[model samples]
Target: MVGLLPRFRRYRLVLLGLFLLLPLALLLGAGLGAYPIPPLTIPEILLRGEGVEYQVLTALRFPRVLGAALVGALLALAGAVLQGLFRNPLVDPGLIGVSSGAALGAALFIVLIPGAGALETYALPLSAFLGGLAATLFLWQIARTPWGVQVSVLLLAGIALNALVGAGIGLLTFLATEQELRSLTFWTLGGFSALTWPLLLVGLPLALLALALLLPLARPLNALALGEREAFHLGVHLEDLKRRSVVGSALGVGVAVALAGGVGFLGLVAPHLFRLLAGPDHRYLLPGSALLGAILAVSADLLARTLAAPAEVPVGVVTALLGGPFFLYLVLRYKREVYRA
Candidate 1:
């Protein structure tokens, strides 16, 4: 109880920091762009909603930043739950083939549709969601045994699924026209370029749903971390937890891929960061990771937009550049701990 109190207090502080940090990131993302809007003038710009500044702030930056935060939160929220559910530090939503499936789906639409019009606005996201849902269901089926979902088998199956999805994407790429190939490449690489308010409508509700599904499972996930038998003994329905975690994760990743294209590693980076700060208590870890993920994503998008000035880099490329080293660090940290044990 004594040890618990200090950890609890630390959790509160970490959570508070994240909440405060998020608005700052949003402000920066909104303010720093080609036509920079001073933070102080942003309110005036938004309220007036008449000038170029107003249009840029209200119509462009607001939705893009907000969408980035939403998708980042979903990715991290799902990552924290999946990590705890599967009891693996390295597990990401992408590990289960959701991103690949979503990418392949987008590729198919880009290559096959052949016409760019209003239909694309709805069609691309729908196709991505269906593809992701299909992968999730297939993964769940193969991983389910008479006993329960087997973590090892799930991981193996996910790898195989990703490979197959990759092949499909490759085939689509081969068939794509020159212009289609550029669009497809950029889409797979990822950006918030397409995330206007209309698109956010499709994503926001789904992100909220993912949050509702995954965040509440924190306590159960914490118990499951003790071991499946221990968790069951403590009244955590191991099967249900596994099901929700996987489904919720796939849903969030699907929305992310649908809206932003293949934004990666916010999932893997955010949860591990929270663990480093406050230990692995999911009550804080899940939401904390989501908050931090939002901050990182907003910041990454900011850098993506500004670093190249008039030209923009893919947010996914930025995240991967940042996350790659951090991933290596996690592996090294894990190695040291294992050697010590």
Candidate 2:
């Protein structure tokens, strides 16, 4: 017991290191941009009183960078949870149509109701959150029957929802006006420049809370991964775990989709990558996935900002172009392993 306690403390220290590093990444992310503030000046500007540079740091870079980090963390965490729950490396929060539904809601607000000027900000995030929440609940209900629950049913429902939402987004795109279409297209692709401190304040704590809640469930999830019947024999409550996973993942996905458009594949990709580095223990897997996810997201955001110089490419485009090929590779690899077995 004494020896085990030391190892546990070491692991806890590693989690602490990750938590500390996140803020540093945000600081660096804020400093890298068109104007390209000096890294040293970043803290100075932030800590010092009001000035032009301070204004730029506080108003422009701080909010956007914080948003990038926060949203990236949320998406990656959601990906970790979803993949663990489904026991499918390909499962992402986006696969369940949550992000696309949010996109549709945001599009409706921006395009169909362009006249809503002042209220647009709150409306878009709220509508997006509602859309995602609705989709998650709908999928959950479909997967849960009176007899019991079936993961395959949930997987099928999510795939169907994704297809339907993608089609709806296309239709909305076709009907949109030229300017509205451009904005809608950009939103779908994802951007971080619209981030404000208020939004970050709202989202960051919820993300933290969600992580705090979900991290403890890692043991049950790891157990269920073996097989639910086996897990049941070992004293795991199937219903309780499922409900907690669905609710926790939904909250993370809803907040992330609301903030960052429909960024896909992070959830699917991050966990597998972490498993490769850190192995399949959910306790280690979850936090490792968080670290890798944040790295991927922040790195992608850096590319998005600099790749086009003054005009930024959407961060989603960067993630998608990279994640798409990676996902295909994983899928093909999984097929080969199945055939081999």
The number of the candidate with the highest TM-score is: 1
Off by over 4 Å in 1: none
lDDT of 2 by residue, 156-249 (tens): 9988988888788788788888988887887788878778887777677667777776777888988989988888998998888877777777
For all candidates in order, the CA lDDT equals 0.89, 0.78
Question: How does residue 14 of candidate 1 score in lDDT?
Answer: 88
Model 2 alpha-carbon miss at residue 246, Å: 1.2
Q: Could you tell me every candidate's TM-score relative to the true structure?
A: 0.97, 0.91
Residue pairs in steric clash, candidate 1?
A: none
Model 1 error, position 31 (Å): 0.9
Off by over 4 Å in 2: 1-24
lDDT of 1: 0.89
